[model samples]
Target: MAFVPAPGYQPTYNPTLPYYKPIPGGLRVGMSVYIQGVANEHMKRFFVNFVVGQGPGADVAFHFNPRFDGWDKVVFNSQQDGKWGNEEKKRSMPFRKGAAFELVIMVLPEHYKVVVNGDPFYEFGHRIPVQLVTHLQVDGDLTLQSINFIGGQPAPSPGPMPNPGYPGPGKHNQQPCNLPCMEGAPTFNPPVPYKARLQGGLVARRTIVIKGYVPPSGKSLVINFKVGSSGDVALHINPRLTEGIVVRNSYLNGKWGAEERKSSFNPFAPGQFFDLSIRCGLDRFKVYANGQHLFDFSHRLSNFQGVDTLEIQGDVTLSYVQI
Candidate 1:
């Protein structure tokens, strides 16, 4: 995986407009992204909608409309009423039980590809003209925690070309480097397949601060270490999953499992960093490319909660993992 470093967009939480706005002009017609939030009755009013052409309000709202009498009668809504017919796909926001749900959506030339809880939820084909999509909407009552764009600049945009002190990849910036931190510090304690333990390595953290890289790149950086039957590598960070960083995994073998969720990548590459950070949400995992997001597994698995510890095997290194 080759990570192209660039400025990213900071999450803007405006209750009045709803939805977090990504970097201006950063959104494309065929781009995909992940939106983390909770769903419930109040969510019926709140939706991930889009607006274009200097509209007075939202151009259209794409809520969970069950009784939508359209081609796809499942997740579409046309009744305009906040309430729509329900389906198995329709779920109570993950935040209700204090759990967070992540949504993966794509911007097609014509529709919005929507995936909920790491699964393909639905595809909205009502073409909102890429130029018209000046803003992304999140209405209803659910709290908007984080909005992560899959692939783009490494750092959030400097806002209208003002350009902050942010530099591109390869630039040397003062980061968390040369410390006592070891790869897979004491944050890992989960059991692996066939009774293998995830805490059987050197048990020390190697602190390597990746300078000049805001949302670290998926390529260029690699965390090499040893592996076991469980063969899982984790990048432990704060306790919340709302952190604004995405990890891209390319080289790997066997199945990949993190804290709350688990998934598969490809053949192992001896040493590689594939898991992204979920702020305080320990074990929140995803595959990345460049500084973009690819796939999101589960939220928090019981076996790996409070997993502020990151354990890696098979030639791994701990670089720029937020403490």
Candidate 2:
């Protein structure tokens, strides 16, 4: 599920350079700070800081500086009592001059997970309690598009399914009250070839969210809603990048079914981040890419409840998954 902004939280759009503002309610676990912008064409360096206060002498809890100078590296550090801490550097750079980018800083219990353009970039351990860092400071060479605070918990461990067999309507387990849509714990930086059980199996209104980066040379990627016991796929969503097509089909009764290859547009691009969502309906499944509706597939199996597992494979690096 796509994360929802907290109540009364408004996103900042086209904020001026060197933007500094107090974080609403301060930083907390399960909250992610998202920034979308483009690096200046002739950029040299840029920095983002989470500090204790807005004053010049404020302590820095997390300092992210991407240097485009001769070093060509990204630096992470902290400062306290006017003294800077040891610098942590990543040699490879993900940001490009004059290119749009999306960045997410997810606050975890132990560390901050930094995702650059939908790829896991780094994990910076906390140098100060997250609650003490109440201000966000962004400056240097970049054009600000928008900044938003998204609310979501970390992904929960998959629990045992109450009923694994095909059951009639309303026979399957129900989603927990606490885990509302867009409130499921997000799994960060999951490995490829990932498979996770659906706590309540397929049901009307259930949605799955997958966010990831496609490698520059990626050929294809596949997402499957499957029946664990019989190895049958209820829905197979495959994006064949090489062919520039998205094939939708099903695998059942030991045979492949007819394919549906039509779509409004192909949203998958090499070296780009994608937000794909699959929402279950009574008769069909709605597929969306980057928040745009792409296509729909009708149910191929009589018992949609039997699709209890989600399997993802191929050339994609997942940054987040909500199932």
| TM-scores for candidates 1 onward, in order | 0.39, 0.68
Candidate 2, residues 107-130, lDDT tens digits: the string is 898998898876789999998888
- Which candidate's lDDT is highest? 2
Question: How well does candidate 2 score on lDDT at residue 213?
Answer: 73
- List candidate 2 segments past 4 Å from native: 1-26, 30-41, 51-61, 71-128, 132-185
Clashing pairs in 2: 154-185, 154-186, 155-185, 155-186
Candidate 1 root-mean-square deviation in Å: 15.5
Q: Per-model C-alpha lDDT, please?
A: 0.35, 0.78
Q: How close is candidate 1 to the true structure, as a TM-score?
A: 0.39
